[model samples]
Target: MKTLINITLLSFAMLFMSMLNAQDTVKKKNGEVLKVVVKEINDSQIKYYHFDDPNQVLFTLDRMTITEIKFAYGKEYKEEESIMTDDYFTEDQNMVLSLSMSSMLFDAIIISFDKAIDPKSGFQITGKLLGIGFGPSFENWYNRSGFDLEVGYKLKFSGLKKKKWEYRPNHLLSGRYIMPSVGFTTYSEDRSSSQIKKNLIHLGLKFGNLKIIQKLIIVDYYTGFAYFGGSKKRTLNSYGSDVDFEYNDINAGDLLGSGNFAVTFGFKVGLAFGQYGEQKEKLKRRK
Candidate 1:
């Protein structure tokens, strides 16, 4: 009777062990069910260990290719795919809008638009309106007004390959960049009874970077110098049938510099939204 009772207990233990060993199943989207033990689950992938292997080698599969995880005890877990990727230079995130006040911070507004040509380069255009309606009361400020249009291309250094460096691929507008641009500007000075207008052509170099938050907010910091050539125009009459003007200090010279160079610097804060992010979400849902 003692030996028979011991045999019965051993049989019950084996049955319980077999039941525990087959406690989980990984179901693929194709309707195949894998009877494996699940070790972990995340938005990107699922990790598990097989039942027959003695070493318990782990395997991970992308959640997009999976359907659901069904446990032996009747619990089920679904997979979710995250839409954001490291590549941000695609259509939705590639375009940027920025505004910077650079002309002595007194009475100027600069608006810029940028488009990523690729992962490592981009193109930008800016419009600067100077002295619209603000008054310069500060000691070192000048009552100057102007309009400028500029075009430039940006080259990024972080896009270069490095040794043992691990970074997300195609991260545009988020690193250090150097840009060379050409622009034209018309500046005016208000005198007691007349206005002095100057037309300038400038070449510039800009160095800057942009930081993004939650894929929405963008913070831009930049500085540069422009070599310019200009010609002066004196308006003889403000408003009259006999309006007159005089041209002075006019010169046709090299594009580099014939007039002077000025420092350009400013900060810009703006928002970012696009269809690329939405497309990723749709793809994730469809998969």
Candidate 2:
């Protein structure tokens, strides 16, 4: 009876040890739960082995897809804690509507809409209405009638750290991006004695940073150059003498003339909507 009791005690101890070495639980963002032996976790991926497999073949998963992990040793890892260190985009919050703050100073109302085609790329369209804002009245130039249309394709760079802080992913559209754009401007400027109609086309490349504030406001600043062409020269007098009239400032020339190279820069403020905005609202409600 003493030997039998010793054997029973040893069996119970072995069973308890086995329970302590059970599999880890991995919960995915899609609500799938995985039973596995986690092997390694890096910045972008998680490596694991199936718990039921005797051979212990390895598998890999994107770290972003995982929401939580409960280890057998009573340790828990939550994905939310590391979200700010990574870059990701949700399907719902992928669009932005912005107004050009700099354009208003030029007596133009420039409104732009941006649509994200994917996490790394998107497109933008801007509509410009000239001579309608509370800008400086160009008294020398009257009857200013024209519109400008611009379209651009944006390519975003990932894995770049923010200058002000650590790798924090707060906004749906926050990063450094390069954009190639095409624009068309057509307008008639009526001077006191001479009226000139100008039509111009330009090809431009821009480098910009977009930042989101308070999960609702967007601030975008960009600087670039545009090659303007396809514009007729301004005839200064009724004699119809074509002269190359240019502005000393590059930005002014870029916005007002053609057949030359000009510098472009602007600031825009706007709103962010969709999935991220919805999430922000939900968090506010919870608070």
Candidate 3:
């Protein structure tokens, strides 16, 4: 409930601010500049006004045209570059403590699938909130959901030095699954069953894009190795050599255990919100 509320309030505030600035234009020191008026923002390449600007002008982002974003009044983003560079993320040690949330279209496992196994394979929207600190490379905490924590590490390499892009492969040791039950009875000789979960290990690759005109935001396309899944497990009876199996009404705990290799592939898109400025990233881009 707390998480939901926080997310709601944050979203509403951001949306409102964006709307209020739709007609405004922002200017920077360098020849590169941005124009913000009311609820609109105009850049050297494109202009965006209102939420749904059908006649909006869009421009191709050019490396040379990119410059540090300056705000009128006293506005700030979530993260800052000086904090990332002069301190943690810098030329000698490029690292950052990052946080993000994501939604996915499909999240499935690599194994073969059928109707039963793929029942929950349709579509899922999940969130990832993690902080990774880098030193030699980058490493930190991966907090998935409710104590589903993991020790994560990542290594990244850029395809091009001038663009705002990066490819990273990350690995993490995640907590086990703690399944909830529905209702069922198991009579496997000794009547053993499963409603609990287990721990897992996973690896993933993320292609990331960083946008720094206003805030430090990240948009990433990601997929992982172990496809963790959620389901309502139900345990029943087993049949004899020639007899038929039987089942009975059960509670949440009656649900049995099953291999959770995720119904579909592990995929999601993530975004990071900030309340400060990133000076270091700006300097790097200019270079």
Candidate 4:
């Protein structure tokens, strides 16, 4: 009777041990399954220990290699973020404030402010402070400032997957886009005794890109051609009198291409400040 009791007790203990050994299964991309007890999951990998092992030694599996994890309770852990989704072309509605590096270096001091009217359209206005003539034009000149404004409609050509189109947001005004703009500029170059003035209208068509980092920092680069119209002249002569006309074999138009046509290239670096300004706030919260 005592031997029978011992056998029955031993059978119950073995059954309990088998139940305790059962755990979740990790499914790998290669179709292998690991019976594991997951400890933690993070952006990079999954940490777990073998369910049936006596020592229960911890192990790590690459998040990319994992297809999914299935638990005994029917819960699952799957990687949801894709590599393609992290690209700069992700759709966003952030206002961009940019400064032209080329204009700052060689031609003018240009500050541009832009805001999206929608996902596909935006407007930009630029304030420019012109530089003084360095060569034979004047002894001293000051105060050359004006504004240029334009509206753009964007067209994107990359990453068009018909299956994912409805799920993925459309980005017309971000990343690789075609940009067309029209603008007007007026500035006066004041010399010691006289002033030269300009009133110009511009039309441009360019390819452009706006890359966002951390969803707050922006880098803008574009290159295209601009057609300029209107005119420029010395309104007040060196003699301090309103001049009727000054004739030269080579006018300002001839030197600057009829004040009409030229190439346009810009590189801008700046910050996005509107709805996307929460990037900094989000980062702080994470810390």
Query: Which candidate's lDDT is highest?
Result: 2
lDDT of 2 at 84: 39
lDDT assessment of candidate 4:
0.61
Residues 1-287, model 3: lDDT tens digits: 99999999999999898765554333332453455322323332333343345565443332223334334455632211111112211212121223322211111111101010011111112222112212221111211121122222323333212222211111110111111111111111212432222233322222222222112222233333332333223333352232222322111110112343321122222232321125346656899
Ranking by lDDT: 2, 1, 4, 3
Q: Lowest summed-lDDT stretch of 10 residues in model 2?
A: 248-257
Which of candidates 2 and 4 is the stronger one according to lDDT? 2
lDDT of each: 0.65, 0.73, 0.27, 0.61
Candidate 1 regions with alpha-carbon error over 4 angstroms: 1-92, 101-104, 133-143, 159-170, 235-259, 275-287
Quote the positional error of residue 15 for candidate 1 in Å: 21
The local lDDT score (0 to 100) that residue 26 gets in candidate 4 is: 92
Candidate 2 colliding pairs, count: 2
Candidate 3: regions farther than 4 A off = 1-147, 163-194, 203-215, 227-287
Q: Answer with 2 or 3, whichever has the higher TM-score.
A: 2
Worst ten in a row by lDDT for model 1: 249-258
Error of 3 at 2 (Å): 99
User: Candidate 4 residues 1-287, lDDT tens each?
Assistant: 99999999999999888779769999876778988988888876789998877787899986767678988667877755445332323345458788776554443656778775444446676665555323333313255544445555555454323222133433433566677777666666666556766677777787878777776778888777777766667755545545344521111211123335666777788877665335435656999
TM-score for each prediction? Answer: 0.56, 0.64, 0.25, 0.51
Clash count, one per candidate: 0, 2, 48, 2
Q: Is 1 or 4 the stronger prediction by TM-score?
A: 1
